[model samples]
Structure formats: structure tokens, C-alpha cells
Target: MTTSESRDEAVGSGDVDFDHHSLTFRDHPHEALAELRSRGPVLHSSAHDGFWVLTDYASVFEAAKDDARFSSAESVGIPASGMPFPILPIESDPPQTQQLRAITMTPFSPGTVKSLQPDMREIATELIDAFIERGECDLVQELTTPLPARLMLRMLGFDESTWRSWVERVHLVIHDRAHDLDAAMTAAGSLLTELGTEMERRREAAPTSDLYARIVHGSVDGVPLDDVQITMYGFLMMLGGMDTTSGLTSNSLLQLCVQPNLRQRLIDDRSLLPAATEEFLRHDTPTLGLARTVTEDATMAGQSLKAGERALLMWAGANRDPAVFENPDEIDFDRENKRHLAFGVGKHRCLGSNLAREMFKVMIDEILTRLPDFRLAGEPVRFSDAGEVHALRHLPVIFTPGPRRK
Candidate 1:
């Protein structure tokens, strides 16, 4: 177990020194997770006032589905997001999760998400047009970041120009939380306030098809959603929508840089992208893992967990479990069993998964078509946090200057 600080020193002799947010974990997460999995499927970590780490596929998958026993109502982050309100959907259990999810799931349905292809392509083209002639651009800033942010803004019924602030606020809250907890909470609070204001505006405006309108006008069990519910739901949308795809796409692009053969395969045959997308989602999972609170005393993988104890379901590690995925470390687009928990499992699965896949495919298609020879211009600067969304802060790439589609 190689780390900046020795294990005993970090853990104080009694508990396992498994700080998910540690520098070692951040730098080489797969290695860190593999080491943890090697130890056992369920190990108590001394980090963040102690929590159980579920590493294997069975434990994580089972726990994810058993929300009755492993509740999400408490906190999804190990250190607990000190937000005054729940993030909605993901932070709630069963009945409430289902109700809240139903409100926003309509727009993300396969048909609806598929209909947005043209719009996504248009957005992708316009973004690429801004940088195609430059020969080099930070992919994160120039493409990966704004594409989703702009689309999320449109969905939220907000002005596209405000994407930058929304993106920054989301990044600060999710990606930078491990570094500065206070700043992250502050950003979360501020974003909630901003979202609340937007919801109020939506209330006065005519009925629209945007997400904000859906939440503002939405009802659960025939009762209209309250202001807090509206804001929290909208806040979840802002966080999940803007961050995950950005990280997944940016991370996949980095993978292409190191694996030239994979890049060429994609360039040669565009049909393989859909499969590749699944593999990438599995291999470079964006939301590393989420925490679950034990509803009652239960034994999982033969480990006793008392009531109220916290357990971190390591989704990334589970995806790579050799017991489920053969040659798990290697990238394989032809993987027949693409049933990975990258978006999670059971009732709490990512509601926007359909849109996320479509977004990834569209962005990849546009980039691979326009910039076939793209290569890493510089090292990618990854976010320091591994507690939630495992994302790259910046990914610099260069390619032969080309003409804009627009």
C-alpha cells in the first residue's frame, strides 16, 4: 500500500487507512481500488469518521439494489454533503426516490433523448467551429465542458450564456469538494439559492417543456412540488447534467491518446462507438462511488454492519471485478456483458442515462469525424477529488487545423 503518508500513521493503528480522497487514491485510483478489493470485499475505512468500503461486484450490486437496508436518505458522500437540503432523487430512498425520479424521467426517455440528436450535433458543431482552426485546444474547456453545460442550460430553461457560471459552481461543489469542503458547501448553498430564484421565475412564466418548468409544474401524488423540492431537484439536475458527461467524455479522450490502436479503430469504423461508449463508461466511470447509510444491522459479505453505519459502494471497483468482467483492466468494445454499474443500479440508477449515452455518442462522433488525428497536446489535469465524480479538470489536445461545419 504505497501512499504519501504511511498507512499506520494515517489510520492511527486501529482502522484501515483507506482515504478515498487521498493523493495516492486520486493519482492511481484503479490501483488503489484493486488493492482494496484484494484485501476484502468489505473493509472498514478510518477515513471520514470511519465507513465500510464495498469493493467487489456482488456486495456493491446487492447493496445498491437493497435501498431498504442500505438507505441513501442520510448522505451520498462519505464526509456527508453539509447541504441544508437533500440533493433529491439520489439522496432519497425508495418511494421518494421513485416519485422524484418520475418527475424528470420523461424528458430523458429514449425517444425524447434520441430526438435531441440534431440539437446536440448542432451544439457540438458550433463548439468545434470555435476551435477547429486553432490546431490545438484544451478539449475540456473548448468542447467537453461547454457542450453539456450549454445543453443543460437549454434543458433547465436558462440562458446558454450562463453555462460558464453554472459549470464553475458545479465543479466547485462536486469536483473540488475533497480539496475545500467549506467552499464546496458554500457553492452548493449558493447554487441552491440561484436555482430557487429560477424556479420562482418559471412559476410566473407560461408553461414550457424545459426541466425547470417540469419541476415547478410537476406534482407528486397530485400535490404540486414545493419550493424546496423544486430547487433541490433542479440543483441535482445542474450537478449531474453538467459534470458526469464532461468527465466521461474527457476521460475517454485521454484513454484514446494512450491507446492509439483504440483511437484508430474508432476512426476507421464509426459503428463501434456505441459499444465503445459502454466500455468507456465501465472503464472510466465518472461518479466514482456513492455512500449509503445502513438502515439497520445487516451482514454483507459476512461483515457485520450496525445500524446507522456508513458504507461507500465502490462502483468503479465493482465494474472492474474480475469475477464479473474478464480481463477487466483491458478495454474491450466487444464486451458482450455491458451490464456495468457505471450509472449505478436498482431504483437509484441515473435517470439521465439515456441522454448521457446519446450525448457521449454525439460528442464522440462529431470530434472523431472532424478531428480524426487528435492527440494529447499536454497532460490532463484531473480533479483532486475521488469522493464523487472522478473527472479531469483540463485535457489539452492538438490536431490538424480543419474547417468548421458551420
Candidate 2:
């Protein structure tokens, strides 16, 4: 309850001292996950007020599919405290979650993301340009934080001027352990206010084509969405579409920074970009896990569970499950089994996967192309909380100062 994970106490049938929310868990996620995977697929953690961990790939996947058994209504994250509201699409079940997803796709669809590529590239260039001549910069601050934030703001049809403020609040709420619940709610409230006002404004009149407009007027299969319902989409926009992708990009770059050989391969041949991104996602999953409330009594992998039990599908651990993946410990772009649940699986899979994947490609493409020789300037400052999302707080890198791209 206090720490994300402290010492072990016994819980359900599968007793394991695993806590994804813990500083200890974040510090050595692989070792901890390995222990859980070895011991039990359905592990009961006496941490964060006792929850089960679905460490094995099969168990997690099966449970992900059985929506009735494993519902998303409780909490998507292991609440350090409590959130005022549940994030839309994520916390909602099918029909509603699926319906909101239908509207959400309009903004992030393949063509939409493709059309924005020039802008994305330009923004990437601009950010790198600022630090390219300095020989060194905090990649997390200089690049990672802003790229996805700017893009997300554009997607949600927000004014560009407020990007930094939103980004700051997002980082504080998500990556900062000290302000997890309060800051998350405060930031969520702030966005809800702005998004609500804008949504109402759009509903009144004088509308243009933007993601916000579509959602405000969105009716899935003819059922209309209301204002409060629409604003919940805003909540999802702020939480799902922003810092999570930032974490993905930052973690990918950090991988390249440390592994010079892996860095060089992608730089030499851009064809490797897509697969490479997958490997990076697999290696350092941005989303550590997702939470589900067990709604009915069930047996998973032969283990029985009661209704109302909380289970965390440890995606990071599942991605690294030795049974499914060969040499799971090694980071291999060419690794044959690239099926990672980094972006979750089943009905509740990440709605922003297209955007996330493309952003990772561009971010990595730009970094390797521009700062080919950049290496870690210092040790990375990782997030204190690694339960919901495993993220990098700061990553300093140094390279030969290069001329700015025209």
C-alpha cells in the first residue's frame, strides 16, 4: 500500500513479492518479472494493496480476450492513491469503448498520420536544430517531450501555444512519483476544462474539421455522444495520446544511445526502422502493464480466481516471456518473434498504435540520421514509478556538434 513494492506478504494462491509500481520493481524490472514468470503465471503480489500479476504470455492473452471475466472498469493503473475518474476507451468496455475508438481513429488513421508526416518531420527537424549545434543536449527535454505533445495537441485540436504547459503537467502527473495522483487529477481537470469549453464551443457553431469536432458530434453506429461523454474522450486524449508515446520514443532513443552497434544498423539502412522499433518496444515496454478487475470466478492456466480480484496484465513481462520469445533478454531487431504486448492485446489494445509506431520511426530516424554518433552523456534518470508506464525522466546525450539542417 505504501510503496509500489516493499517486502513480501502472502496474498492469493500464487504468492510472489512483485510490485510493478515499486521503485524496487522499476529498478530491476527484468529480474523481478523473471522471478514472477518462473514461479507462477497468475502471481499474487502483496504490494500496492494486493494484486495478481499475469506474467506469462498465454495467461495474459487469454484474459485480455475474455472481457467479461477480466473487465477494465476498476483501474487501468495500480492507483498510488486514486484518480477522480477512469480514462475513457481504456476503462470502458466494448460498444462504448469500441464506439469512442471509432471516432478516435478519425484523427489518428493511417492517412491522417501520413498527411501530418511533413509537419512531424519539420517539427523533428526544428527540435533537433535547436540542440544539433550544441554537441550535447538532454534528449528527453530537447526532443522526446515535445514531439508527441505537439502532435497530440494537433490531433485533439488544441492551440499550439499551450503545448509546453500541457506537456509539463503531463510529465509531472505521469513520470513524477511524488505527484502521481494529485498532479494527474489536477492536470486532468485542467484539460477537461479546456477541452470542455472547446467542445461546447464547437457544438454551438462555427466548426472546422478536426479530431475534436468529430468526437463532439460522434455517434457510433447512430447512437449520439453527449458533452460529458465527449469530454471523457478528452481525458483519453490527454493521457493516452501524449506522454505515453513520448515514453516510447525516449525509451527507443535511449536504446540506440547505449548500443552503438544497433544504432549504426538502423542509421545505415532505414529499412530496419520498423522492425527495430518493434524490438525496442519489446525490450523496453513503455507501458509496463495494464489493470483489470476480475469480474467472475475463473481458472487461468489452471489457477482459480474469485470475482472482484484485481489482476495486472504485466505486458512488459509478457513481452519478455521466455517460452514465447527466444533469447528474450537480448535486444534483437531481427528477432523472429516480434509479437510484443507493449501496446496491449485484445479489444482494449492501444488505439494510438499507428501514431505511436510512426512517431517512433520518425523520432528514431531523425536521431540516428542527425546524431549518428551520439552516446549517453551521463546515466539516465528513470521514472521513480514504473507500474503503469515505464518511462525515462531524463536522458542526456553527447555527440559531435553538427551543422543545422536547412
Candidate 3:
């Protein structure tokens, strides 16, 4: 049989069609991955134009570190989107990636995130007040969506009024691909154009600590980033920070909605929230795994891969590998090794993880304290194509009224 037919049969000869970019994994990622892992360590998927899926932790982490062999110099899109411009350090290889990463690191430093905590809490509280007395609200629409957008505004020195526009447009660009590709690209183009204008504006103004100023004035190898590079960096910040965290918040909250028992567990012991956070990240990671290109022909987990090929380092799959975690499907916050590949592994690890963690902690804490009894008001909506971003489009919840905090 040809490789295409074999890949089609890779998941038990027609029993289940497993494609990394298909609605199958997006809707049933755990179930589908459990089946794939049972087959072997790696399987070729015809999804998103055919790519390799890394099914185990060992394989994913190893390939992540071994960039020379599984290089990230080209488009990292699982199906390889052939992006016109690089997403800065993420698309750059080795030495150059290092330099670009350095220029982008200072703004997301731990200290910076710590200083932003008060702002984070304030944002969460303000969001709760908007619909707290209504006895029901779509958590994704009311809180999760706006939280990241507003935070990004504050972090990057954008006008607070534009937060809603930014949030709506960014969500469309990243998560609406399945329903509307033209709209997604249009949203992306608008964001990039706005970013270019913002970058130029910041450059002409006084330097500040916000990411915009840093990127506009920040130098790489003692040279300022050119228009394309600066704009790309800004684009990455908006893309990387906004929708991913929004989805993470929505996904984690959905678990709380469905698993009432888990909610009580968190309520009983708030300290476990940190552990719970890690567990949620492990089980229902929001963003899809980034793409890595194959530098040369190689064999991984008994699968023969050719040079110039792309491999999706699927973190969502690896974190659930039973070989690595005992009772892989179950959520155990007490697991000794809480280190999941949620933020990814290796040099390309998430730069803004600290910011993300703080947002999750603050958002969840606010929800539990204010609306402990919130339950699903309606069915949650998810994306049609789980290829790029695994997120909820809508999540409605019902709860009793609570006094708004000043």
C-alpha cells in the first residue's frame, strides 16, 4: 500500500480515522490519542496535508531539543502554512533564534509579571461585576475573552478602548479558521497593520518598559529591528499572548463546569489550585502543538521520516502518554511529576508562561469565590478544525447572584 493508504490505516486498519488536524482529535483528543499511542510511538496522518504525529513524551521532548535534526527554521504549522514572514525567534534556527529570543525576553520576565498581578486581579474583578448579578453569563464571552485582551493592552501600552476590538479580531484570526479562512486572514492582516503603526508610533515617542517600546527600540546584535522584524515581533506578542490564554482559561473552566467533584476539591484546598492548574494544562492543553521541520531523513519511534518533512510535536498527546504517566487518562494533581509539556519543551518554550500562570490563578480564584455554583447554561461551542488552536467559541454558565465587589 502507498504511504497515504498506510497512514489512513495507521489507526487499526479502518477502525478509527485519526488525523492530528481533524475534528476527531479536537473533539476527542484524549480518546483518539490513546488509540494512536496503542498503535506505536509515531504515526503518519494525512490531516492538514499529511504530517507525522509524535505520540509519546520521550519522543516529543527529544525531538524538541534536537533542533538540528527536527529543525524549526521553516514554517512550524503542522501542515506548514508557508507564512510569508517568520514569527521571530520561533521560526529562526539556533544562534539567530537565540539572539531574537533575548530581545523579546525582558518584557515577559518573572519580575515584570509579578508587578502586573494587581492589574490582573483588578481586571478579573471588573469582569465579574459586569454580569455577576444576572445569575448567568457565558464565562468565555464575559471573562475569558476580555481578560487576556485587556491584559495585553496594559502590557503592550495599547489604548484601553481598543481592548474589545483586539480581543475579537485576534480570536477570529486564530480560532475561526475552520468556519472562515478569509475572515481569519483579514483579521490577521488588520492586526498586523495596526501593529506596524503602533511600532512606528512607539519608536518616535519616549522609550518605556512596555513590550511595544522594547521591541521598537530594542536592538538585536546592537542593531534595531527593521520594520518587518519589529512588526513580526509585535504580531507574535498579540498572537502568542491573547487567544492561547483565553482558550486555556475557557478549557480549564469547562472542566470545572462538567466536573463538580473537581470544583469542590479545588474549593476545599485552594493550594491545590496550582497543582490543579498543571493538571488541567496536562489534560486539556489549549493551543495546538507548534510545528517542527525535519532537517534530514530520520527514523523516529520505528517510523521512517524523510528530509524536508514537517513533524507536529503534539504536546497534548505526549502529556497523556500512559508509558510516562501512571493512569494517563486520569487527572491526578498529586502526581509527583507535575511537569507537563503544556508550555512546550526546549529552546522554543513559551516566553510568557509566567504571565499565563498568573492569569489562570487569578481568573479561577475570582470565579470560584464569586460564583461557586455556576453551571452550564447551554452547550459549549468549540472550533470545527482543531488543527491550529484547540479552544471554545462559546461557554454559557448559570449561577446565583452575588454582590459586586467595589
Candidate with the greatest lDDT versus the true structure:
1
The order by descending lDDT is: 1, 3, 2
227-259: candidate 2 lDDT, tens digit per residue? 677887776777776678778888878767767
Native-vs-model 3 lDDT? Answer: 0.79
Per-prediction CA RMSD (Å): 4.6, 4.3, 3.4
Candidate 2 residue spans exceeding 4 A from truth: 1-13, 176-180
Q: Which stretches in model 3 have alpha-carbon errors above 4 Å?
A: 1-17, 178-180
Q: Which stretches of candidate 1 lie over 4 Å from their true place?
A: 1-15
TM-score of each: 0.95, 0.93, 0.93
Question: Candidate 1 residues 76-186, lDDT tens each?
Answer: 998898788787878999898899889988899999998888889989999999999999999889888899999989888899888998888998988767779889888
Which 10-residue span in candidate 1 carries the lowest summed lDDT? 1-10
Cα deviation at 21, candidate 1, in Å, is 1.2
CA lDDT of every candidate:
0.87, 0.79, 0.79
Error of 2 at 399 (Å): 1.0
